[model samples]
Target: MTSDAGPILVTGTAGFIGFHTAVKLLDRGLEVIGVDNVNDYYDPNLKEARLARLGERQGHQFHRIDIADGAALNAVFTQSRPRRVIHLAAQAGVRYSLVNPHAYVQANLVGFANILECCRHHGVEHLVYASTSSVYGANTNMPFSVRQNADHPLTLYAASKRANELMAHSYSHLFGLPTTGLRFFTVYGPWGRPDMMMYIFTKAILDGREIELFNHGEMLRDFTYVDDIVEGVVRSCDVVATPDPQWRSDVPTPGTSKAPYRLYNIGNNKAEPLMRVVELLEQRLGRKAKTIMKPMQMGDVPATCADVDDLTRQTGFQPATPLEVGVARFVDWYRSYHQVA
Candidate 1:
């Protein structure tokens, strides 16, 4: 599905995945209209840095607006007239959701509704949005698959994302909008979010601060690299979703429907122990982390693995970055970005 009609609208372009996804799109000679609030969710400086990089690209145009503001977002849609919308803007973080539940409501739920309306009205070719592995909350099933039951979300963050999947299905059914929801798992690499496990461990290890190992470091994560994630996002964006003829109302699956809606998991597909990640960081940084064991916090999962079979079958791509290589890249970026000798 080619969209030569207008630029691709990518929300949250200043974010880790969005930044990389925009670069990939621009590299493919596509005109991209990037949108982001650049909120102080973490460090605005880092967000600015990512935006600056995107701004350097010739085919890229940026708008500093929050997706929660329906009017502002709609204006961008009016002016840009994007054929495809990559909606990645949302209040991200499971633990933070516990503290600021309203942020999740405003950004994930309300903001998503606004996005859906814009896409529906603007005649978007395909709307690819970020979902999360967190939606597989409280499910002890190994290698989480999109076809499984994901109704039991453990936090507002997870619930909000799960809601996005359902909300997208409605648009696909009602408005004939093609929507694809990507469930990303433990994404980390250069320009990664500071709130994520990779950044936290690297910073604590470098500063010689005690890093708390939740679940006594027994947690397992898919730990996908940022580049691998970008590949999935871009590939998925190019493929417009179609209604599944195999979909049955009686024996329905969450991944596909009779509507033009689909869900896929983007992850390394191999779960690695959390401590193994720490060991890799220690090896790369040449410093042993000052670690303290802690019980798993509420709304936190002990393990996450992705079944990327659907994503692979659809896009002919699967996340293959090894944890060691990915950790090394992140550590290198952290050292340079923080100006740590």
Candidate 2:
């Protein structure tokens, strides 16, 4: 939606999802202020490449600043005077959390607090931030639902995101700031992160290397396409969260409250086996992956399926991108981006 109000501020513009989100906003003829440090998280080159693409678009302003630096982040808010915000910046990676817990604390915790304060003081109409399905840690439910309690986060990354949902709720209650937290499942597509399973498997297979299938390739994941995730995010930004009239104190729901705060699971709503993805990639790439079975690693869930009924009801949208279609698109992009023969 094109807004006549002030520009929309989006954090993590250099990131995979953030880059795609910024493009969506810009294409809609909206002024987009992009904030990103372009850190050496995975590959600064790739981040810069994404930034270069955004720079070509009209109505896009880029700022190189870290969100953890509250002063710098506040400066952006004061200067841009954004009408709304979409926060996607965070220290992502479950295994990386084990090695560097401080990173998660600084980026996810301190950085998020700065964002909340900015929105509170700057009169942001709605704050839509990214959460992860990893918050459903230790819950064996077939399909993860926002109504269910997400109290046991296994990794620091997951715990930090769960904390963001709680932090957003507090702001909504105290300052009347509307907030929406979307717990995303495994998002994959073009311009995907190299650390994710899809990217790693694709690269290794193309290079004639063995692709490790953790948990013996038996894992089921609701692998959402990036375009679908961005659609849900943009729609949530358009629909400001309102207090649930039916909310009760005696029997409170986890996803909604009396305040203008809500949470929704944005996913494909179907769990596909890990091997299914591999097969799709093989078919697209014209090469079979040398598969290696491996045990489950620490801080990883065995399966994830999203219950997107609430998202559908609220946004009139459901992530319906089939795994086969999405994988084929990713492979095509990978080949083009890498300039492979």
Candidate 3:
């Protein structure tokens, strides 16, 4: 069932979520044009390997270009003329932004700007970009909702994503470019980022080393699996956003607008405790983790829970993978990939 939409363009196709999304689209028999600089943010080899897997699939194309390079990005969009655009490339990592602020400015800000510009000029029908749960910063809200106010962000990384949402809204309003932004919650699974908690903890535990338990292992997260995130992303991409007819300026909804723009939180509604996640990982690995409990670090949220009602209503998308199953699968992949018993 090949799509008449021609080739789909996926930016940041080498990254974790982007890679999964690109794979899903390719599996659906759509030609995927993947663009990634393959930067060594964590490990370039991992990025290269992910790209290799995508390359193995028929109808998958790869391009090495930084999205911040306006000229390069424009040329790609012009040549590809993709019907849909999934812009996921960015300088990710909250704590890392503390050390390298410019990276966020270049990748998140400039790169995103370049993407929006290209999408606008190229008449992209649907623009699906990745936002983050961190945008709900400093709020005491449980089960974070996309319709809530997210003006206050806790980190440079979160702020950058917030800016992206605003930037997308403007494009949708002015250019009639239907756009959807997904605020992803603590996504993890097989082939996940090495910098993420699950991967770090699993590796440390397998090596008989102590794993740092931030916030004394009392934190909670909506640990959405990569597969579920990919599913939500692909579904959202297929559904074009439309302006909310009921939107009122006096009582504006943060997640919807009079423009053809919408935002949804693609996350597991269940917030699993950090200690429970570790326990599940240990159970899966058949090894005890030496936990080094410590206070929560800066740019860290103690808890995150997503309310995906809007997502469900819009796309009927619900995260299906349980923490235990996801954790077990991650451990299986980690053991085989790292050659650990």
Q: Order candidates by TM-score, high to low.
A: 2, 3, 1
Task: For candidate 1, give the lDDT.
Answer: 0.92
Candidate 2 per-residue C-alpha lDDT over 1-341 given as tens digits, one digit per residue, 9 for 90 to 100: 56585699999999999999999999888999999988998988989999999999999999999999999999999999999999999998888999999999999999999999999999999999999999999999879999999999999999999999999999999999999999999999999999988999999999999998889988999999999999999989988999999999999999999999989999999999999998999999999999999999899889999999988899897776899999999999999999997
Cα distance off (Å), candidate 3, residue 124: 0.5
As for model 1, its CA RMSD to the true structure in angstroms is: 1.0
lDDT of each: 0.92, 0.94, 0.92
Per residue, candidate 1 scores C-alpha lDDT tens digits across 1-341 of 44354689999999999999999988888899999999998999999999999989998999999888999999999999998999998999999999999999999999999999999998888999999999999998988999899999999999999999999999999999999999999999999999998998888887889999988988998999999999999899888899999999999988999999999999999999988998898889998889899999999999999999999998998777888999999999998999999
Listed in order, each prediction's TM-score against the native is 0.98, 0.99, 0.98
Instruction: Point out the higher-scoring one by lDDT: 2 or 3.
Output: 2
